[model samples]
Structures are given as structure tokens and as C-alpha cells.
Target: MSEALLDIRNLELRYGAAVAVRDISLQVHPGQLVAVIGNNGAGKSSMVRGATGLVRPSGGQVIFRGEDTTRLPANKKVARGLVMVPEGRLLFPGQTVEDNLILGAYVHGGIKTPRSKATLQRVLELFPRLRERLHQQAGSMSGGEQQMLAIARGLMAEPELLVIDELSLGLAPKIVDQLIGVLADLNRTGLTILLVEQLASYALAIAHTAYVVANGRISHHGPSAELARDPEVMEAFLGRKKTAA
Candidate 1:
């Protein structure tokens, strides 16, 4: 296998004496879709923030493309091709959809360059609803449409590594399935992704490798298919009862 595109080593994070992540280490390689699945309060989002430089890690090394970027700010990471779609779809509520997309490319010079313009065209092709709502306020859309905008905005950054936090949060099952399909298609086209999702079955179904986080630690790591079939993992994270052998 090639060297990891994003390598996180012994990551420890805290919020004012409360340890959210403890000695967590992981890697995501080029073109691979990796899933981090856990119940609520497992610190999945915290770990992502540390990796992406949204929050400086209390302790750890975040290596991207072989450079130590542990202390870099979030914008710096985005400039270097690590972008995130945060939880809650954090769109500019009052801004037009086009404006939100333009803001996403701010680190890349705000869609003025030829390359950025081509990216915008591609993103619009992927999400036609966004094209239809280009002038519409982002907050005025339905939850599913908003989620589509969030992912489209993330793509506007032209990320080599897209880390999405909570892809299935609060959306209908049909909407979640559609987004998951979109992610799978993106990965097929060589986009590396790290998905942190609460719905274990949906995430595991799409990921090549899976990590099960519990109580701020990784309790299991393996191939996603195997993990999905493991009775223990299913019982714990998928809320399935084990039947008699």
C-alpha cells in the first residue's frame, strides 16, 4: 500500500480537563474511503477537528502528505487539500447558495481562476438542485437540500482528502442513502474520504475499512465488511441482538 495521505499518531484531545480523545492513532490512504462509527459522545468530531486543524491537538502529530501539520490552522489545512463538511451543515444561513460555494473556494482564490471555475461547473453537475438554487438562501432549503449544498461546498475546495462529520445526522433515511451513494461515487473517482457517521450500517456498507470508537477510544479496527458481520460489533453499535448459534 502507498504511504498514508493523512496519518494521525497517538492523538490526545481535551476540552478544559475533559479528555475527549485518548491516544488515538489512524491512517487514511489515497483513494480509500474510511469510516469512523460510534454512538453519541464518542469524540469522533473532536478527533476530526484536531486532524483538520480546526482545534490544535492537546497532544498528537497530524501528518499530511508527509509534512507535520499538527499546529497549522484550519484554513492552512484546507489550502493544503484537507477539507471538512462539519456537523450541522454549518452553511451561511442568510447567504445565497452561490455565495456559500464561492466562500468555500476563498482559500483557492474565490472561483475567479479558470481551475476554480471548472470546479464550480463540476460541482453543479453533481448536485443539480444546487444549480437550481444558486441564488436561493442556503437556510431556506429543506434539510436534504441543505445537506447536498454542504457537500457541494466542500467539493468547491477541490479537496484531496474530504473529512465529513455526521453525514446522516437528522436527515431522512432516503436522503442519507442518496448522500451515501454520492460519496461512494466520489471515492470511485479517486477522492479520498473519511466519514464519521452515527449510523454504523450505512457507513460500514460504503467504507473499505472501519474503526469503531467508544468512550473516546478505538475499540475495533478491521475491514468494514468483516466488522459489519462481527456479532460483537453489530450488537454494540448497530443495536442488533445476537441470536443463538
Candidate 2:
């Protein structure tokens, strides 16, 4: 069996005295699309922050490619190929789309390098709409286009595991569908993904495995197909329960 690409063992995260995540553990192996689904305030975002080094974990280890990266900062993690398309599609609003993408390649000495230039071209091909608006102000676009650009920016880093938070945040259903298809295609081409999403149905559609997070803990986990069929999962999404299995 292939070794895991990312592993979080008994992760504990806190904000002052309040614990956000308690003993949460997860694993993403090579070439797998894994989803973590939960409602708002379920500690999903907090988990991503800890995993990607946006915030320090009070406990546990973040093992990436068999190396301990728990204490590394966000930039270091990005340099090591663990990139996140953050929540809220945080693009540089005043900058041109091309400028934003170039900034994403900063880890590789900007896009002036041949390898970085080729990667930028591939990213543009993946999101042709971005190519058309390369010179437009990033904030001038629609919500869906901005989200696409945010993802495209992350791609400029050439990540080994792409972690996306709240993919369907503020977009039409059709737009969300299109973006999800793009992610599926990326995964098919050997990109490992760990998607943290509130939309369980969409996330499960592309994931091989999934974990249902509740109250800062993993309440249930299994194949995405099975989780979708589970009554507990349905009820959790419907707000009928505080926990799921």
C-alpha cells in the first residue's frame, strides 16, 4: 500500500481557553480525494488552520510526506507543496488576475522561471475564463469567477495536496457544479485533495472517503457513498442532530 500523503494524529487546537478541535485525526493517502463535511462552527475551518500551519496546534502532529510539519508556518507549508485555497476567496482585489497568479508563484521565485511559467500556463488552461480576464481587477469579477481565480492562484504553487475550504460558499448551483467538475478532473490526473465543505452532497460526489465532523470531533467516517446513504448524515445536514454516525 502507498504511504499516506498527509496525516493528522490526535490534533488539538485551542483559542485561548476554549478548545476548537479536540483529538481530531485524519489521513489522506496518495491520489485520493477525501472530504470533511460539517455545518458551520463545526471546527472544520479550525482543523484546516492547524493542519496548514495558519494556527499552531496545541497538540498532535501534522505529518506531510512522512515529515513532521506541525510547527511550520503557512509559507513553509506552501513551499513544501501543501497549499490551501482559503475561505472567502481571498484574492488581491485591487490587483489584476495575472498579478495575483504571479504572486501565487512567489515560492518558486515568481513566474519568471521556466518551470513556473509553464505551470502558470497550465493553470490558465485549467481555468480559461481566468485567461480572458488576466488583466482585469480580481474584485470586479462575479463570485464564481473570483472563487475560480482563488483556486487557480493556489494551483500556481504546484501543490502535492490541495486543501480547499468552503468551495461552494457564495455561488449559484450551476457554478458550484462546474467548479466541482474541475476538481474531479484534477483529482483524476493524480492530485490528492482534502476538501473541507459544508455541502455534503457535492463533496461526497467526488470523494472516495469522507469524515463527518461534529462538535470538533469526527463523529462518523467511511466511504463517501455509504456516508451519503447513512440516515445520520442526512439528519446532521438537516440540523436534526448535533452529532452523526
Residue lDDT tens for model 1, 22-128: 97889999999999988889999999999999888999899999999999999999999999999998999899999999999899899899989999999999999
RMSD of 2: 3.0
Candidate 2 residue spans exceeding 4 A from truth: 239-245
Say what the RMSD of model 1 is: 1.9
Steric clash count of candidate 1? 0
Residue pairs in steric clash, candidate 1? none
Candidate 2 per-residue lDDT, tens place, 140-220, comes to 999999999999999999999999999999888799889999999999999999999898888988999999889899999
Give the TM-score comparing model 1 with the true structure, all chains together. Answer: 0.97
For candidate 2, give the lDDT of residue 232: 69
Q: Give the local distance difference test score of model 1.
A: 0.92
